[model samples]
Target: MKPRKQTRTISRIMVPTDFSPGSAEAFEYAIALAKRLKADLILAHVIEPFPYNLVEGMAFSDYGDRLTPPVQRLLDHQSKRAIKEKIPVKTRLIEGAPFREIIKMAKRERADLIVMGTHGRTGIDHLLAGSVAEKVVRLSPCPVLTVRSVPAASKPGSGKARSKSKGRKANVLKDKATLI
Candidate 1:
């Protein structure tokens, strides 16, 4: 019998989340992987510059105020989870394009892997906006793991009395749920 070939061992994992269900699922996977590998995890969220820089008179501070709460909630919730689980964790918040910021975080952290979610936006949406996860995969210095969100039917809290809530962090609405 041939011995199993050795591959890379993960040391640090970077996860850039938008606080979507897909991102939540990716967090679960990353936590499990980090636990097994004894790897550190970095959670990052990006506050995307207002589309088209068309701030339309919005002040940068005001824009930040509008954009940061949700992202902060999500990041804080996930950070707590990692800490509770005893996974070494760090968090970062930045304002920029999602893919670029995610890649930058991975490089800055020297991450061995990145686990994140793909919203699977398609058709006009994909054409007009493009996919952040796709860009990350293409440009990431480390290996990327993209997790697609499950359907609503299979999503957490879907069939349950209550959906899996990020607790207080679940206060924000979806659409542009959370960011840095």
Candidate 2:
């Protein structure tokens, strides 16, 4: 009998979240994949620093009272949940532009892969607003997987199905794979 070869490629996955629905989907997907692959997961949230002018207006004590505890609580809660679910995870909160911070963390941690969500904006909307997922996919040292949410009622052959077909066609042009 021939021996089987294992083809699993990911050892660690970094998922950056803003606690949005899309990010939540990415988190869930990452956890499931990690469980199957027995890989470690890192959950990152980047808090962009307030503008200098804004920071200058606040008292140091006020800033501390208003910011640190809530942020820490959120990270602690998420980390505990991941551990309780039996998925090895490390939670981090950094200060910077989300895309740059995510990329920096990924490289620093030597993450094997990144799983993130795209808001799926286009044209003027996309141009006026840049996407963290798009930037990460373009600049990250390792491979990035982007996930988008599909509506619940869009059955095959329905009118909504046409939109999905168009999305798939666009994805081919954009080089995105819908893993879910």
Candidate 3:
């Protein structure tokens, strides 16, 4: 008798967003991919907690009045709105570093892949500020798909705009071809 062969299925996909234009593009791409693959999509955002001193200075009355329920409600509403009329999606709002929260959520949900955006910074910007997508790609248990927003001039022909099609580009993981 022949041995049974096992096939892997991509059941879930995790998408982490910072709400930037690049992230929004990634969200749209994730939605399309999720629909095509028949996979569950998780749309997540991380709200870093208020600084310790800020929290410490607040009085109990102020804390009760200003915090808790309202924030939870707002997150819930945003998540619902983002998911509405879309493919099967589960939304989450977590507290921590964005990359950490993303990885943690992916593990918790047992996601098969993660899709995110890169800011495409260069020179001092790229050196001084690293990317969360880069870090996540290195550390994530699942495969990471990093999407780069196409420059306005690069879309078809913008005439005067020269294409940097050959040189080394930072913040772009892999190549522009990977996006399609």
Candidate 4:
């Protein structure tokens, strides 16, 4: 008798982007996965709440209004790429802490997987600047994949030397879920 192959069905894939290079890389990764799995992409961007409602007691009701258009344009541009590849996608713009919102979005959309980017900050940097990707991986309702930006030196045609230092750092920055 022949052994059977097991497969997991992924109907929706949630990808959160902050417009950073790492985020862009993750988006591309998610695109490929969506194509391969014949799944829909859910592109999400979160806008953090403003620190204060008023500056010198001057209320700013248009804060969200002013911030949303530009971000929406970027999100639209990303979605178009998936559309060009014939992958279905939807965009979500939410206001809240990024990691929390991403988790909530994934649950609400019933996504099978969440793919996002990590900056790979280490040591003091990682401690001070907590990772959103890390939090999502820990809290997400579904599986989460964190993609890191490819170092420029590691790319083909780049003469820069690849650093060996990564092997020495806390593996969490190197590979979030496994390290934890």
Candidate 5:
């Protein structure tokens, strides 16, 4: 019989955030995991470029201009909170397709874990690059821990959930096992 191989010691955790409530919840999960593992947490947000890049007369566009700041603010807020808690935190906001940027960042940073949100709003004409979380899971170089969507009826302390979870986290785990 083959022995069950152990995973690598986690030193860095990459969390890709789209600033949605689900991603925020995922951040909470990542932060908790990082805290427990004594690993550095990286908050990554990808600024996907505008589709149909230019306007005939405009020569340029304000599409991305209006978008970047608010997302950066979200990233900063999360990073600040983690740092305040004495956690080693880093944040990266890159301009590119969300999935590609996330996967590249994970590889470059050598992240031991990639924690991401499941469903998020689509972007730039709803490009085929749908659901950044799904793509990352398909392409990530390391383990991906997805914080699954919570059912609308299952509040934190509901008796139905409390019984089934057996003290597991209230949020479901939609583990994506693709290793590309």
Candidate 6:
């Protein structure tokens, strides 16, 4: 007897955003994919607490509370894009370690796939700060798709005319030590 082929259906997609440029790109990608797949989106934002002693006397809970509104606004704005595409979107505002929360949410929602942004950090920076996307990818229960932000210079129609002046300034800035 021949075995029947099993086709996987992606009914739910989870997108975790940090409101960064990379995340914006990922969100847009997720929106288009959701529309094409006819899948519902679960947009998640995790409000990571300030590192120990990073905020001096301010309590971690207080720091998270102050950031909640702005982060929520960002989530709402991204959701509008999905809604405009006629794709159903559910937003999750969570406070904890971002990677852990993202993993938990994906499993809790039974998401078939997770689409997120990668900052593409490397070497020293990546070693010290670690990477939420990397951690999530390692631990997630579902398939992970990571999107990296494209540099403006590489985009089509960027043009040599615009690059002449702005590009020189960018190069100079790139040579200097960046203050975090």
Best by lDDT: 4
Of 1 and 3, the candidate ahead on TM-score is 1
How close is every model to the real structure, measured as TM-score?
0.77, 0.73, 0.68, 0.80, 0.73, 0.81
lDDT of candidate 6 over 21-50, digit per residue (tens): 778767777776777789999999998886
State in Å the error of residue 174, model 6.
29
Off by over 4 Å in 6: 53-57, 159-180
lDDT of 1 at 179: 26
Superposed on all Cα atoms, model 4 deviates from the true structure by an RMSD in Å of: 6.6
> What order do you get sorting by lDDT, best first?
4, 6, 1, 5, 2, 3
Comparing 2 with 6 on lDDT, the higher-scoring candidate is 6
Model 2: worst 10 consecutive residues (lDDT sum): 167-176
Q: For candidate 5, lDDT tens digit of each residue in 112-169?
A: 9998777534586347646677777788899888775555465567677647743233
lDDT of 2 by residue, 1-180 (tens): 989996658889998888776676666667666776888989988877655536767864465357656886876776665576687898887777889999999999889889887777889998998788888888998889887754445434787654555313222323333432
What lDDT, from 0 to 1, does candidate 1 have? 0.78
- Judged by TM-score, which candidate is best? 6
For candidate 1, what is the TM-score?
Answer: 0.77
lDDT of 6 at 159: 64
lDDT of 1 at 10: 90
How does residue 122 of candidate 5 score in lDDT?
57
- Model 3 ranges with Cα > 4 A deviation: 1-7, 50-86, 157-180
All models, RMSD in angstroms: 7.0, 7.2, 7.5, 6.6, 5.6, 8.6
How would the candidate models be sorted by TM-score, starting from the highest?
6, 4, 1, 5, 2, 3
Give the better candidate number (1 or 5) by TM-score: 1
Clashes of 1: 2
- Residue-pair clashes per candidate, as listed? 2, 0, 0, 0, 0, 0
Cα displacement (Å) at residue 174, model 2:
16
Residue pairs in candidate 3 whose N, alpha carbon or C atoms collide under 3 angstroms: none
